[model samples]
Target: MRKLLGIIFLLYGYPAFAQADTTQYRVAGRKNLPENYGRPYVILISADGFRYDYATKYNAVNLLKLSAGGVASKGMIPSYPSNTFPNHYTLVTGMYPSTHGLVDNSFYDPHRDATYNMGNKAMVNDSSWYGGLPLWGLAEKNGLVSASLFWVASESRVAGIPPTYHYKYHNEFSNDRKVEIVKEWLQLPEAERPHLITLYFPEVDSQGHYYGPDARETEAAVHQVDEAIGKLVAEVSKLGLPDVNFVFVSDHGMLLSDVDHPIPVPELVSNRKFVVINSYSLVRIHALNPEQVRPVYRQLKKERNKDYKVYLTRHFPKRLHFRTNADDRIGDILLVPRAPKVFGSNPPSKRKYPGAHGYDPKKVPEMKATFMAWGPAFKPGKVIGTFENIHVYPLVAKILDLPVTHLIDGRSKVLGKTLKSP
Candidate 1:
């Protein structure tokens, strides 16, 4: 247990965030708001890896009370693969990961002849890898201003627009400090205030990864987020900002992963015919040629056991919404491990977490996420059934009256009923 605690501390280095980019990135001379500045303010907050049952199970007092007064869902189903970067981007983009071209946390972009990795700062900030327009992009392009404390791809100029005010990813700032910063943004002048604001918390997700979902460490992380959110609501209320609403969500959830008996990498996977990436939850094999796909897939299927399921690109369930819209980004072959088990071999991350996600949320309900909303814009004391996170995008757009001029996977009708509107 001591070893586990020590590893948790080492894996998460708040001090290292000091060396990272800590400046608030602002677009020069672009503090302008739309002619109709009456649009409601939406603070979209994501607590990474917050499970559907967390608030209730842990008795997160503030969250339970706040959500009770507003709207809460049984669960918010994350897009397939249920990983952090993909689903966070999905929540704001209104598209599935494949549709958005962010197939996984890391994927091979055949067209770019490059790989897009969540850890690769250059790749993450590159606009070309992204397909869908994020909420911030939609707001900015339509003459509204947006800000993000930290969100997946928020720093990137996706669709040629970054949030008017944003900060590059950094963990140095404490939860209380983040809430303070958000309150300050709301206090800005009408022209400079961001109607669409996004805030993210990583502690719960980070702790779940290091200590498993049921550990005391995970509970503490959940409470910490609950406290910060309570503080945010209290502070923001002092400003008397009308039509201010808050949406609290999470990318995905965590499960106690079976790290003791991991699914070993197949031998043929090492062949040059494919570019393989083991992204914890699944193994993506991007074959060099269509011809190379069949032989390897057959071999994998023959060897497949209870540990994992292997599929040709087209064979994946359409309900998953994977491969129905994308093949290149999702790869030629997918090795989806039965949850609790992940793809690994002789050596990868010398140390690994007992908790993992990135599985199909439909199958592993443990991957189901969280969704709650409050403030004047929401119908009070409403409880809704599970819905995909993509629907969140249109819900925000509807709240702010932003036009989503393009066709995307998300349908506001799924969540539109929760609003105090037609």
Candidate 2:
């Protein structure tokens, strides 16, 4: 038992064995922020399910200006399957959905032996279920106050303290109210100011799911949200906080789903071929009653590719690094469709509208989302070739000057390049 415990300790880092003993992890500077006095405040905004083309397609002039004048990726690659809960968690934790244990928007927790849905605050807010520290938690730990507006996992406690300010989950809040609240917080005095602030817009994703990705209503919602964003930016510019930074990014881009079709899960389940845990456009399947796991996995892969493709959990695509650890709660098989369809226990159903995002993050050329950053430390008009969602956490840590031990999935270089060196 001691030997096994030692290995677990080594894998988790010897320091973690100390197990979150204090409110302060470590502080770097006088203000407990990165060395540069001119380091700007960062506002990470998420336009859930907004496609990359929305700027040009919908004429989002304010967003376009930021993209053109500051760093923006051609496409920001998301965690595998590209679901909302996992992707949002990844942005702050710097860990993939697999590593972080949020495999999909919904899944069954074998340990609790119950269904865990992403929208359920009771389930998602439990710190025991979360594997990594979120950006706000890290900031607050190092003496910086942090705030969030309707972000997934924000309700979860960090260092035993809640965000300095936050809103409970509520789908009813209007976009205008969201802007008003963020603007109010930004107006707070510097001493009482939140060093990290996150704002989420759910309309784009909501509309896309009921309609196709390019649905007229979805386009309209994108425009509306952009206008809201414009208002916030205008307000921020007027406040004049020295070196404040603004980062605009999306969890994952949207994809068009058939309004009339859903994939069948019973066919695979009845045959004892696979177990359906949860699904969207992408499905997670565990090998049921494995007689020979590899051979069955191979056959499952072949059968799926006729309409969709499957990757053994251990053999996921290299770029994602999603399936890196066997204990990451990944399924034995992962299924992704080339077309727009979701698999569920019931047969295909029809509605007037349908859209989805759990498709491969790399698929759907237009599925890529946009990112933009502008402020004191970042170079104006500088462009980066590629960026990942996980990079955001490190960037947050760097700007706040919080000391973190883990190297995380992303690099400081991606965000560091934007800053003027000390």
Candidate 3:
């Protein structure tokens, strides 16, 4: 009986247990806050593609100091397809890619009959493609000011409200410039200052893609970002805001890819009519004709070997927590390559860069990202085990004392362990 109850709780979160306080942590409801509520200031920072090991391996002085003084996790596992936009959106919305409607960095949306690409400014700014209310939107609705420095989907208005302040994403911006912008937002007057802010730095991910995860260029990039973080921390400390919190996270980590071992997609699918969306390690196949589904599935299944795993969306593994919705926007079939390997239509050039991600997070340790919290609200000098990235949303919501507006998959108890007692 005890074992069965444990399984139930694991599947349904604390709500499944009779003794749990469902009212305080209700997953869906309107929450009203007092006109002058006292909420801690929170700053969420994302260092894109900074792997779990990079925190210690690359001599990142700022991250190391933060980890030592506050709560740090072994790693933060990203949602399946473990790409940038999907996982970053998952962090803020507490929903999987299927639930949030940003299934990939780039994907075709059948409902809108449009293609949403990360690089296309107009499509990125379109609010129709976004499904869940992001953290900034939730904060704004609850009367708290929020600002964003290039978080995915932050530029778009959700529920008819954008962040109180946000900047258009520009990759050319230096890490120091991004940090300076966050500092400026923090320097506003008490009434005008944002209670929640998000900052992103993409240098590490860029270097990792161009020079592999272990290369000296990646290490240099990590150090550069770390210096910027140190400067930001100093600026925030100067403000001396009481009960300020900092949550450092990453979208997903990178894996060392071998240019020599490319799994050709043509070998797995003989049919030429399918639309293949390939992201190196993960491949999504959408059949143009309904008749081609079975044959495509059969061909891919037969080709599955030590190098890759294939699954029909309906039969996707339960552990991934993906393909939950009927109109998930995923392809008819999904292909995930084994670690250090990639799936592509053509063989990679010998000169091609040698690192990638978007593999199953459970299988690749290198693909695991970092999560660390430092603030008055968090416990000091505590190190916890790995957790899913979705849980970050509820943690932030709890700190800001706002009610979640939708039914999200994240569990408060999973992340509540990192916080100090109220």
TM-score list, all predictions: 0.95, 0.84, 0.88
- For model 1, residues 67-126, the per-residue Cα lDDT tens digits are 999999999999998988889999999999889888778888776677777767777888
lDDT of 2: 0.68
| Model 3 C-alpha lDDT per residue in residues 88-132, reported as the tens digit of each score | 999999998988888888776545546677767677788888888
Mind sharing the TM-score for model 3?
0.88
Q: Taking the tens digit of each residue's C-alpha lDDT, what string does model 2 give over 1-422?
A: 23323332332122323332222121222232333333346788998888767777888888888666666666787777687788888988888877777767776554454556664557767766667788887776777767788677787774465677776654445677777777777776665567688888876776776666777878887888888888888877887777667788888887776535555653544454555665657666665445645776677766744566777767878776667443435666677666666664354343344666766666565456667776665676777765677787887778767777865776777778876676
Each model's lDDT comes to 0.87, 0.68, 0.79
Top-down lDDT ranking: 1, 3, 2
Q: What range of 10 consecutive residues in model 3 has the weakest lDDT sum? A: 21-30
Each model's Cα RMSD: 2.5, 10.1, 11.8
The better-scoring model by TM-score among 1 and 2 is: 1
- Residue-level error in angstroms, candidate 3, position 175: 2.3
